[model samples]
Structure formats: C-alpha cells, structure tokens
Target: MRKNLFHNLALTLSLASSSFLASYPTRSNAEGIMSSSPITVVVAEFINESDANWWKEKYKSSFKNMLTNALSNTGNFTILEEDEEAIDRMTKKRSLGIIPGFGGSKKEDDSLQAKYIIKGYLSEYTENEISESTQVDFGAFGGGRMKQMFGKMGMNASPGGTQKSIKEVDLTFNVVVINPRTKVRAFTRTIQGSAKEEFLSEDVDMGFVKSQKKVENKFPIKRAVMQAMEESGKYLNCVLYLQDDCIDEMDAKEAARQAGNDAMDLF
Candidate 1:
C-alpha cells in the first residue's frame, strides 16, 4: 500500500512540476536595506563584465529591474532617472524659467528632488560547472542482485547514490553610490555570494542518463545576481548622507544581508 502511495505521489509531483529552464532569484545570505525618506538619485546602467554572454544579450533589462527594486527597498533614495522624459522636461522648464510650481499646481514643487546617483559594475562572475554521472544498470535502488554481486567482489554497494542534479555557484559584484551635486564617489565596495544544491528526484526514472537534461538549474546565475543585489543597500547611507554613521565593507555587507532578510516578506 505504501509503495503504491509513493508511486502516486511521485507521479503527481512530476505532473505538477515543469522542466528546469530558468532560475528565479532568492535572498542571498547577504541582506537588503530600507531608506529613511526616499533620497532622490539617478541609476546609471550597470556595466556587465561577468563573462555571461547569454545574460548580456537577453536579461540586461531584468538586471536593471532587480537593481531598481532593490534600491527602492531602501527607504533613503528615490530614483530620478526612472522616467527620462520627466527629468528632461524639468530641465527644459528650468532653463526656460517657466518654473514648475508657479505655472502648474503650486503643490508641485520641483525643489524636493533626487539628490544622488547610483552605479554598479559587474566586475567578476565565474560559474564553474562539473557534472558526474554513473550508470544504474541494476535494480532501481541498486540493492537487489546488484548489491550482492558488488559486495562479494569486495566493492561497497549503495554508495548513497542519489537521483539528483548537484550544482555549485559563486558570484561577485561591485557598486558605487555617487552624489551628483558634489561629483563625489560617496561609497563603493565589492560583495560576493555562493551556494550549492542537490535536486533530488523521487521518480526512479531519474537515474544517471536522465540527469543530463537538468543542467539549467545546476548553476542558477540570475538567482545569484538577485541575491547579491539585496544586500548591496547597506553602504548607501554612509555614502549618501550617513557620513559619520558609516560602516566598513564587512560591516556594511553584513548590515545589508540582515536588512534583506528583514524585508523579504514585503514582496
């Protein structure tokens, strides 16, 4: 009865799951942040040097979105360059002396605006993938007749073999907070994160050769990038306006990581 139940469960799960084609972002061990009053800033395009060719062509916009979302989580800064046309109109109006509030709604004071800019450079990203597959020619669990033969031949059987794809990942990135008004680099640092996972399959059909098609989840790069972004907010304060309350790279990174954890449920 239990065997039948297990089989039904396996079949049900398989039917419900989709093929591993993409990976979504999760909170990196590094944390995230929240701003005090929405400090205004312009976010420059992040320079990508991570050697990920596919991501460069297709997912660049997603990377930008991740940054925008992460920065928004920090209560301190409000993004200004998000709407280029609005900023351009404001600039043109100032030059024409048409003033935003006097002619428009006096409530639309343009003076309380973006105060800083944020920039990021993806300096280093390395995904070293190694796959090992062992053929299972014996019983599904490899413990029936196959076990007896291996044991008599002085070989250890059932080496804790798993029908799961194992993967490891490591990532690094650097970011800078700039005060456009002062033309100063307020703060900059490189942050890193890494993770490994084994995707276990309950279906006995997931033996050896079946595992090859599951490479996409082996090294989840996009997820890694998202995690790095979450914790990057820690140092913005020291660079933006938290001068004396500033933290060193290690402290800032830790703060960012913890802050990310605190903010996870909001999304």
Candidate 2:
C-alpha cells in the first residue's frame, strides 16, 4: 500500500509541473512590454491672410483658440502650452550651437520636442450681389359682385409661403504636420468648400446677410479640420504602435483557452 501511494504522489507532481511549463514560458512577462508613456504635441500660432491684409492680433488669438480646441478633442496626445520665455531661450541656444553645414539647427526652437507639430494658414473671402426675378401667378376672388382683384407677393415670398435667399461663400484651409527634430513633413492636406445659403432677409443688407452666411459656412471648415486631425492621429498611433483598449486581457486568455481545448478535442 505504501509503495502504491508514493508512486501516485510522484505522478501528480510531474503532471502539474509539465502543465505550468507548457502554459507559460519563463520569459513570458506581459507587463514589461506594455507602454504607458504619454506623447506630447505642440501647436504653432496660425497665420491668416484675407485678400491683401493679414488678421490683427485679436483675430489671430481667436484662431489660436479654435486650433487648440480642435487638437484637444483628438485625445491622442498631450498638447504643450506655449511659453514665450522658454521659446526665446531655446532659440538663442540653437543659434549659438549651430555648426557649419548643419543648416542652422532650429530643432530646439520647437519647445515641446513633440512627436508631431501642426501649423496652418487660413484665408476667407466673401461677396454678394443684388438681383431680381419676375414671376406670374393666378388667383380667384369670390366676395364681391363681379369684382376683380390682383396682387403680387414680395420678392421674399416663395411658392410655399417660406422665404429663402441664396447666399454663397468660399473657404480654404491648408494644414501641415512635421517632425520637430528631423523637420520632415509627415503630412500635408488642404480642403476647400463653397457653401450656399438658404435663408437671407432683405431687411438685412447684403453685407450683413453674407456675414451670417460666412458664419454658417464655418461648419464645413470645422468638419474638415476634424477629419484631417483624425487621419493624422491614426498615422501617429501607427508609428508609436499604440495599443488601445479593444478587449480585456482576461477575456482574451479565456478565449484562447477555449480555442485550444476545441482544437485538441478536449471539451
């Protein structure tokens, strides 16, 4: 009886050791390979020109705010705040450190040392014209003795009693992304749109109406900017080998175990 018991214990120990070794290799530590470092991104001040004039400080400030908001929405990288003092210091350092044939190294001017930097220019133009149209209509009157009445609706009236006017505007945006250190452009894309307005009132002059129309046209600009950023973010993530939360690790392990069991015909 004692010999039989000893043989059974040895067999159990051997089987357990073999199972552990087969399931997990000695170097299979998943934690060490996962990265938790956050990437930094910087936005340079945008320059805008309209017709022959550049926007003043106020408009430039507004544009910067818009750009910052768009970038933050991407949720892919940390955006660095612009520090004028730090930027000046870095620029001076770069100028002093430049070597011959090095092309005046200005990489240090990019304060963020970001994986990517985005810069762009925007230009907008708008125009409006006054025009007139003539139309014919038919109506009947039945409240007077052989009385005839004729009237015309104003230019604002449509066939459906709804007033609509057509206004148009042009928008153009150009965006470029570059690697700060190498100065190599990673991406460059431009998008433009011509938008037509459906509502304009004669009570408001063409200038006021067209101004409103231009505001409405900004919708397309916002959409284009978002699309460009999304594409850029995809490229950045690819370069970094970014891992997003697609599935839980535990769930994946359970799936693998089930698959292995099915393959081995061991339900």
Candidate 3:
C-alpha cells in the first residue's frame, strides 16, 4: 500500500497545485511604471530534520522545484542556476566581512543580480491512521451488575462499549526568503496542510475494533507537502518585496481608476 500510494502522489500534486497562488505586484518606479527587469531568484533544496530519510530522498526535487517554478509562473522573476559551493562561500564570507569598526561588503555580491534566496525545511512529515467510532449502550446487553456496582459507589455507569477514535495526517514546513547582501530575513512563514482520505470503514460501531491492526493512510507525505507549498507560494512575492501592506492600496487605486473610466464613458 505504501509503494502504491507513493507512486500516486504525483497525480495529487498536480491536482493540489492547480490553483495558482496570490497575486504578485510588479516592481515599479516613482512614476508608477512597472519595471521590466525580471527579479532574479535562486532556490535551495529544503532541509529535512524529520527522521524520514526515505521521505526526504523521495520528495527533495518537489520541494526545490515547486519554489522556483512558482516564481517563474508569475512571469515576473528569472530563476537563476546557482552553484551550491558559491552560495555557501558567500554566506560564510558575508558573515566574516561585517566588523564593528570597519564595514560590510562582499565583492561577489556586487556582481550577483539575484536578490532573494528561498529557504525552507520540513518540520513534520508523517502520516497516521484514524478510526471511526460510535457509542454502544451496554445496558442493552444486560449489564445490571455493572449498574449495581456503580450505584453502590454513587456513580452512574455508562456503556463501556461507547468509544470514539479519529485519525489524520499533516505536513508542515517553514519557508523564508532572504536577502544575501544585507543578511536579512525578508519573509518568514510556516505552512501546515493536510490531505485526508475517505473513511476506511463507515460502520462507526465496529470501526475501532482491531483498529491498530492495520494502519490506513489517505495520501503520501509528498502530497501533503505539495499542498502546503501551493498555499505558501501565494505570499512569496509580497514577503520578498514587502508588498503585503501596499497591495490593498494598489488594488483600491486600480478599482477607483476603473470607476472613473466607466463614468467618463457616459460622456
């Protein structure tokens, strides 16, 4: 079952990502003219601290590719092929160059056009099984002895067969966009999403019987991660460029402009 579900995760990913993320604002000048320069961005594969090595190895490409592809799909950014060694060097060298008395500068950064590096990590990547439950009245099965014992103890005895169980799966991650030049974390967010499958057994009364015998999973971890990425990608541009606050202003202005144009059409 694990192998079968793992193979089907790709299909779920496409279905999950069908809806594109939020609107992205174009960089503009003082004249409000949009800048044509494509924002350059680089992506690094997310780190996995989850003890699931198989999971990390399975979905590493999805984690990295989704970020870059999400940006590119906006048609406002250029995804740059970056060298891992060069990026590591820049990070270490940048930290070293900042001195209290001196200044902060890096020669390599001067030539680099990419302004943002998308970083991410998996906080949790696991799935668990769930069981449906219903309460059964043991009084119908003639439990007068239990009632008498409870009555002596001044306690009302309810049906011991009354049981309830639930199960669910979750995928969560922390994503950040950073500016290498200033060593600033531009945008930081944590996204948690889940994909639940149909109930294995609709008979609530019997669902919990031997529940632990078989673990039922609705979807693979990759699907849940993909679902999370799709949602987080919505705020990518806003966080990277600090456009979250001003997006509302821009939309209102555009709406007013349209209203004025409609009024003039009456002339």
Candidate 4:
C-alpha cells in the first residue's frame, strides 16, 4: 500500500507539471522546429525613402533589427534570422534597389520557411529646432534707482534671463506583412511617432554677444523610432494571436491619437 501511494503521488505531480506548462506556448529550437503552434515570421530589410542624408542603409538594417526584437519579445511568434548578405545582393540586383519577393528565397529549406514576411519603409522624417531668448533689463522696467539697488546685489541688470531651446522630431513609417507562399499582403499598417526635448540655460546678453549652455545627445529621433516600434510590436502580437481585446485597445489609442492631431491642426 505504501508503494502504491508513492506511485500515485508521483503521477499526480507529473500531471500537474504538464498542466502548468501547457498554459504557455512552446518555443522553437535553434533548428526552427516548433513543438506546438507558433507563427514563424521574418523581418525583411527595411527601405529608407526619407530625404535625410544621415538616414543611411545601415540605419535601415538597424530598424529591421528593432522590429525583429520587438516581435520576438511577444512570445507568440517564431522570429527567424534574416540573411543580410542575400538581401543586400538581391536589392542591388534590382533596378530600384528594392528586393523582389520581399527577401524570401525559394531555396530556403522547409524547416526554416517563414509563414509571414514583415516589411517596412520609412516615409517621412523631420527635425525642427527653435530657440528663444527673453531680454530682461531692470533699468528699462523701473528706473535708475531700482537698477542701482539690483546692481549692488551683484546683478548685471542686463538681459539675464534664461535661453530656452526646443527640439522636435517626427518619424513616419509603414509596416506590411506578406504571405510568402501566396505572395499576397496579409496586413499593412502606418505608424507615426513624435518626440520633443527642451533645453534651458542661463544666458547673459552683453549687447555684443550672448553665451548659453546647451545639452547634448538628447536623442529625440531615437525615442520617436522606439515609440513607433513598440506600438508596431503590440499590433503584430494582436494580429498573430487574434486577440480581440488587444485589437480594441489599439484601435482606441489610434483614434485618440488622430483626434489629438486634429486638435493640434486647428491651432
């Protein structure tokens, strides 16, 4: 009876472990073999259509990596490693530098075949900077008596206010998911993100020249790109798993964003 009881307890623990693990999806191994259901996806090299000279081809590849990482973080998709050399050669072979078949090759083995090929292109990018300075002269406000009192307190009494500088960056990009076998577009989305940074420094205008301290490496553009990609990842997660609640949340957020944009345009 003791031996039977121990066997029963072991069986119960084994079943409990299986039940707990069953709630989570099985991940693919390095060979790209999924033990269970997981959508396999590949991120193609992104295209840079922006007119900015600093937006180089390497940056496009970097964006592709960002999207790949975003999708991989969802835990519902099997993200495949793309062949950069093959994609670059294919892009160069084409006249417009656009890869045909969206970077999917027929020679790819069945084990590594991706069901979805994610593509992206940057359409618009803009960065604007503005600086404003306020002239403050106590002498102009009051008279010589007030200016003399402030001067005795170690104040220059010239333009001694603050200089403020604002930098804003806007980025717009499109993501498309295509079925490799059918060569048809499965989903397409346009994502836009904007970021702003401000710098305030003590300024003194000596009437001939002005000096102000400025900050460095604010990276507003990088923040904008990261924000857009975060949204893109959530959207892809909803699409792949058919999560209705996530879809509704994304729609509501997008509607609110559009409304905000309209309100801004009215100004």
Highest-scoring model, lDDT: 4
Q: Positional deviation of 248 in candidate 4, in angstroms?
A: 2.6
Off by more than 4 A, model 3: 1-28, 31-35, 51-54, 90-111, 133-167, 199-218, 241-267
lDDT of 1 by residue, 1-267 (tens): 999999999988776664332243235312333333657666666677877554564344566567778777766666654443444444444445564357554323353255555677777666654555554444345548776776576554444333556576767777876554455676677776667666554322322322223333536766777777776665564556343435565576568866875797588
Q: Write down the lDDT that model 3 would get.
A: 0.61
Which 10-residue span in candidate 1 carries the lowest summed lDDT? Answer: 203-212
Q: If scored against the real structure, what TM-score would every candidate get?
A: 0.52, 0.44, 0.52, 0.64
- Residue 166's lDDT in candidate 3: 52
Return whichever of 1 and 3 wins on lDDT: 3
RMSD per candidate (Å) reads 26.0, 15.4, 22.1, 10.5
Tens-digit lDDT track of model 2 for 123-213? 5544443434333223322543212232222221212122344554555556566665456687664434344445432322222222112
| Winner on TM-score (1 vs 4) | 4
Q: TM-score of predicted model 2?
A: 0.44
lDDT of 3 by residue, 107-195 (tens): 35532546677788887666676655654443333548755665576544543332234545676678888876677997776666677
Model 4: residues with Cα > 4 Å off, grouped in runs: 1-36, 84-107, 110-112, 136-161, 205-212, 255-267
lDDT of 1: 0.58
Estimate, for each residue in 144-164, the C-alpha lDDT of model 4 and write its tens digit: 876676667655667577778
lDDT of 2: 0.49
Residue 163's C-alpha lDDT in candidate 1? 54
lDDT of 4: 0.73
Per-residue lDDT for 60 in model 3?
Answer: 62
**How many angstroms is residue 236 displaced in model 1 relative to the true structure, after the best TM-score fit?**
1.9
